[model samples]
Target: MKIGVLMKQVPDTETKIRIKDDASGIVVDGIKWVMNPYDEYAVEEALRIKEKKAGSTVTIISMGPKRSVETIRTGLAMGADSGILIDDPALEGADCYATAKALAKVMEPENFDLILCGKQAIDDDSAQVPQMVAEFLGMPQAMVIDKLVVSDDGKKATCYRRIEGGAKEVLEVDLPAIVAAEKGLNEPRYASLPGIMKAKSKPFKEINLGALGLKAEEVGAKGAKLKVKKYFLPAEKAPGKIIPGEPEDAARALVKMLREEAKVV
Candidate 1:
């Protein structure tokens, strides 16, 4: 089986984001980057699948600036067989559709039997790329799946998708389908010392638009239909008010505030 896992590099969740002065984007100068937390589950799931199927290979694929290589290397250390990084100046600011287009273009020739990715990247939280990639490749896709079972012959995949009310929707799709992994799918493993060392020797390929057979106008900012007009932080919340009196008095005060000041009653 050949499995391809889509990966993304995003700002660490704990990092404090600051919008750019011109509102074009976030300030990246001092931000620490890490693999999208959701993608970690996808990587772990891919590794598990590879272990169960002999002669299987897991490849990590990503699109971003040069710094994204670190994210791919992290996946390599997590036991993916190889890594492919799509890096090009023209790919900067590529929106979800363009990103999916570029990734689909790259993977079509590889002919992977299965594709997996996180439900969403944390940075933008768009949650659109994986489905778009599946559409571009003309493959069926199951999103936010928490459970997966591949057939013994590796010709089909059964996925359990979590929906509202804690219900799971079971879907079975033929081979060469895409799945967007959600949290609770599996716990991601840390890179072992030996694994890290071996990752350095693993096959890693970096390609650009030209290599992907994509024209400059077909990707990146030029190809993006979505545009960020401006970014602004949410308005600061007011401090809470404390009603300190008898319980009965406090209850009455709270009710008053709810009905009058807050006007929610």
Candidate 2:
């Protein structure tokens, strides 16, 4: 079995951000980058699948600038068989669709039996790439997967999906499908010292857009179907007021505040 795992390098959650003067994007300077937190779950799940299937190979794929190789190595250290990085200056501002399209093209010839990704990248939180990639590859996709079971023959996959309001949905999907992993799917394993050393020798392939047969205008901002008009932070929220006294009094006060000061219903 061949399992393809998609990971991304994103600004660390704790990193302070500065918007560019033109609002085209955030300033990269002084920003620490790390693997997307959710993608860790995807990598862990793929490694578990490979462990269960003796001949299965887990390949981690990342798309970003040169620094993304560091993120890919992180996955290799977590036990993925190898890593592929699609690095090019043209891919700098690729949106979700372009990203998925490029990744689909890169893996189409690789012929993976299954694909996995994080439900969403923390930086953008768009939660759209998995579905876009599935569509581009013409495969069925299961999102927010918290549990997964592959058949002995590797022809089908049964999964439990986490839904809104703490609900769970069960799905039985065929092979050659994509799955977006959610939290609680599995605890991600830390990279052991030995594993890290072994990863240093793993095959890490880097290819440019030309190698992928993609032109500069066919990806990144030029090919992007969606556009961001402006980027700005939300206004600071006002501090809350406490309602004192008994339940009945507090309820009345809340109603008054909503009807007058807050003006809601």
Candidate 3:
């Protein structure tokens, strides 16, 4: 089986952020970038399936600037056979649709048995690209997959996913499908020294818009249907007023606040 996993590089969640001067984006000058946490789950799941099936190959695909190679290399160190980097200056500031369109264009010519992605990218949290890719490819898609099982013949796959109100649903789809994995699907593994060394020697193919035959107006900021107007941080949280008293007095104070100030009771 040749499985393709779509990965993303995002600002590390722990990094402090500041709104840019233009209020159009966050300042990333000093921020650390890492693989999207949800994508890690997708990568781990793909690796597990490859191990179980044996002789299968896992390929990691990422679309971003050259810096995104670091994220792809991380996946390679975790057992991916190779990586592809779709880097182009014109691809910067692409919205969900354009990004998905670009990815679909790149993948259509490849011989892949399955495609995997995180439920959403951490930076945008749009949760729309996977469906868009599936639509573009004209393939069946399953989202929020928490469990997966492939048939021995490799013609069909079953997936268990979480739905509204924490309910789970089972879905069976044919081969050449796309799956968006959720958390609890699998635990990611750290890169061993040998794996890292081997990854350094693995193929890392880089392609651009020209190579993919994408028109300049078909991607990036111009192609994006949505625009980021402004960004700002939420107001600081109000500090709670501490009430000093015995249990009865504290209870009375809480009730008074809830009834008067909060107007909840």
Candidate 4:
């Protein structure tokens, strides 16, 4: 079995973000980057499958700037057999649609039996790539999955997808399906000293827009159908107010405040 896991490099969740002077995008300078947290789960799940099935190989694919090679290395450290980096300056500001198109183009030749991705990237939280890639490839997609099992013959997948109101749906899908991983599927393993050292020598492949046959107008901000008009942090929340007095008096004051200050009565 060949497992294709989609990984992404994103700004660390705790990193401070600053809007660019021209408001074109976030400032990348001095910002720390790491693999998307949910993507980590996907990689771990792939590794688990490979452990269960003999002769299975896991490959990691990522599209980003040159630094994304570092992210790919991280996956290699976690036991993926190989890594592919789609690095191109032209892909800098591409939105979800164009990004999916580029991935579909490259994945066409790989012809993987299973594709795994995070439910959503932490940076954008769009949650669109897995579905879009499935659509582009004309394959089935099971999203936000917490459980997954491939049949013995490797021709089908059974998974449980998360739904609204904290519900889950059990589904059986044909082979070559895309599964978007959710948290709690499994506990991801940290890279050990040996794994980290070995990752340095893993087979790495890097390609650019030319290799993917992508047009200049098919990527970056120019190719994005959705544009950001403004980028700014949300306003800080106000401090809580205290209602002081007897229980009855506090109740009356609360009613008054709701009717006048909050106007929700």
Best by lDDT: 1
Tens digits of per-residue lDDT for model 3, 1-265: 8899999999998988899999989998988999999999999988988998878999999999999999899999999999999999999889999999999998898877889999999987999999999999999999989898888887888999888898989999998999999999988899788998889799889999999999768988899998888999999899978988998999999999999999999
- Clashing residue pairs in candidate 2 are none
Residue lDDT tens for model 4, 137-163? 998999999999999999999999778
Off by over 4 Å in 3: 240-253, 256-263
Report the number of backbone clashes for model 3. 0
Residues 17-76, candidate 1: write the lDDT tens digits.
Answer: 999999999999988999999999999999999999999999999999899998899999
Which RMSD values do the candidates have, in order?
2.4, 2.9, 2.1, 3.0
- Report the CA-based lDDT of candidate 1 relative to the real structure: 0.94
- lDDT per residue for candidate 2 within 158-234, as digits (tens), equals 99986779788999999899999998999999988899889979998998999999987888889998888877767
Clashes of each: 0, 0, 0, 0
Candidates 1 and 2, the one with greater TM-score: 1
Model 4, position 34, has a per-residue lDDT of: 97
Off by over 4 Å in 4: 240-265
The predicted structure with the larger TM-score, 1 or 3, is 3
Q: Which candidate is the best by TM-score?
A: 3
Error of 4 at 121 (Å): 0.4
**Window of ten residues with lowest summed lDDT in model 1:** 160-169
Task: For model 4, give the 10-residue run with minimal summed lDDT.
Answer: 227-236
Cα TM-score per model: 0.92, 0.89, 0.93, 0.89
